[model samples]
Target: MIDCLTGKILKKTPDTVVISCGGIGFAVQVPAATGGSLPAPGREATLYTVMNVTENDVSLYGFATEDQRACFKMLTAVTGVGPKAGLAILSVMTPEKVALAASSGDHKAFTKASGVGPKLAQRITLELKDKVGKGLASGTGFASGADVPAPAGAPAQAVAALVSLGYNTSDAAQAVARIDEDLPVQEIIKIALRSLSRT
Candidate 1:
């Protein structure tokens, strides 16, 4: 039931972070979208959280923005979707893109996520399309300007590589956008790796 957490970032990895609050450290799994926005370790950050409880384990998922958290909640509500799967979807696609894909019945886009298959992708679109509009209207879906930063120069090429590696277009674009335009290809790759690891 923890709605949010504010603390010093103690550690970070591609998909996980440890935040220290009140002398206790909390490990939170986050989507790539949220991971890219995180400040460096030792900085203070706040994340909206969704706590998932089960018979055998408990996990906390964190989001950089309320919109992303809302999207996660919506995604997990589909019958066959679990928190990890929802995080995988968010890691690949932004909430806005996800809404568009669902509304437009773009099963291919939905299936681009690591573990999502054709049937589940189609089912996601079928079950979530109508609900997506509500989230969009409420401003809980992806905002128009919400984008990850990417590095500079040959962005299109880098993005293509990332897409080939299974990252969705939005994620690739954002990661590439964060790079400086003058950076060399190797530097760009390094930055992108750093960005992806935050997820």
Candidate 2:
């Protein structure tokens, strides 16, 4: 039920952060992306958090944004995906990329995460696709371009081109998917970059 915590950072690490709030320190597990964005120790910061409880243990997971925390919740909702696995996936892919990949049925993109095998990746995609698709189609959840269906042929090439430029695979794919598939790769990339830069 703890929605967020805003306090001074007592410690920060790649996988966890200790924040002191109201004279108490709470250790929160976070993905690498969130960890990297955190202020240094002794600096003030805020984290959106989710608390997971089991018969034997209770744990806290944190993210830089509500989008990320929401994604984590969605990820852990899938069968066979634990909070640690969710963290592992988020460590490599941003929440936006994960949502795009899920909605696009790009299972392979998730396989890049540690501990996510092809089978699990496929399950994650299949289950999440519908959920995320509903959210996107309803215009209630993700930001723009999240559920874009990658166009056939040339648009795929444009997505690949953007991936080479250091953009997340699903993100690039969704961006290219929003444009005309007949456009040349350069134009697609240019348009996608412009769209992405605005975010």
Candidate 3:
């Protein structure tokens, strides 16, 4: 039932982070997307969290944003998708990409995540396609070109290319915005690839 945590980050590993609040330290597993954005140790951080209870153990999963936490919840709601699996999915794809994959029935994208099989990907798309649109739309959807400012010089053209390549306007804009203004289109794509690879 723990919905959130606000504390100082005491420690961090690839899969988990320890946060100190009051007099206690709480360890929470996090997806790579959230982990990448975490502040260095000793910095104040806040995470939206979900508590999972089993007969033998209790664990907490944390996200950098409510959108991520909500996506985690939605992923776990599917049959055969547990917390670990859900985290794996989020670790590999952004919430926007995930929503797009589901809504567009792109099982191949889902299958790219570690531990997710083709069948599971298909099932996820089939089961959650309708539900994902609302979540995806909640924050400008996956194609909100406005979220990420366009790069200078041929910015318009780059955005058009991204749109043609299956990315929504928003996703394309964010990806382009992450690149240097002077970088060429190919370099921009490379940078975006590196960023996505980290996820």
Candidate 4:
């Protein structure tokens, strides 16, 4: 229930920080990036937090933003992803990138984090592909583009082509979302590739 914490930083390690609030110091496990984002030991910072309680242990995990916190929760919800693995993913990619990877079927991105193997990475993508954008991202194009849904003929073909070329579906859709839907799939793919390269 520790939704957030605001206080002076008492100590910090690679993936943990101790925050002092009202003279009480709280040890919080955080993504390494979150620990690095904080100021030195005396300055104040705030962490959006989630506390997990189990039969044997209770732990507090903190995130740099509500988006990261939400992303962490979403990632942890996957069948084999524990809090540490969730933190590992966030430590490597931001919430936005996580959404992008999930939607794209780019499971390799998930594997960059320690303890997340090929199977787990693929599982993460499969499980979250349709769900990450619901709460974890906004305007991330996980909705890819709000004005349009995944297209029918040429556009759908373009998306498929992009996916075959190693681009993820969400990214491919976003890249082609604003282009003319009536164009040939090849033309759409070319335009999308051009546009995506600039990003």
Best by lDDT: 2
RMSD of each: 11.1, 8.7, 8.2, 8.6
Q: Candidate 2, which segments miss by more than 4 Å at Cα?
A: 137-199
- Candidate 2 lDDT at 120 equals 98
lDDT of 3 by residue, 134-176 (tens): 3333333423233221122333345456556666644554555
Q: What is the Å distance of residue 106 in model 2 from its true position?
A: 0.9
Clashing pairs in 2: none
Q: Residue by residue across 1-199, what tens digits does model 4's lDDT show?
A: 8889999999999899999988898899999889888889988899999999999999999988777787788789889999999999999987656765676678998899989999999999888776643322232323434321222356556666777787756788567656787688789889999998998
Ranking by TM-score: 4, 2, 3, 1
Assess the local accuracy of residue 74 in candidate 2 as a C-alpha lDDT between 0 and 100: 76
The residue-by-residue lDDT of candidate 2 on 69-129, one tens digit each, is 8778778879999999999999998765676578668888889989999999999988877
Ten-residue stretch with the least lDDT total in model 3: 142-151
- Measured against the true structure, the TM-scores of the candidates, in listed sequence, are 0.68, 0.72, 0.69, 0.73
Instruction: Give the distance in Å from residue 17's predicted Cα in candidate 3 to where it truly belongs.
Output: 0.4
Q: Give me the runs in candidate 4 sitting further than 4 Å from their true place.
A: 133-199
Displacement of residue 169 (Cα, Å) in model 2 is: 17
Q: Report the Cα lDDT for residue 11, model 2.
A: 95
User: Which whole-number lDDT from 0 to 100 does residue 98 have in model 3?
Assistant: 70
For model 1, what is the error of residue 106's alpha carbon versus the real structure, in angstroms, after optimal superposition?
0.8
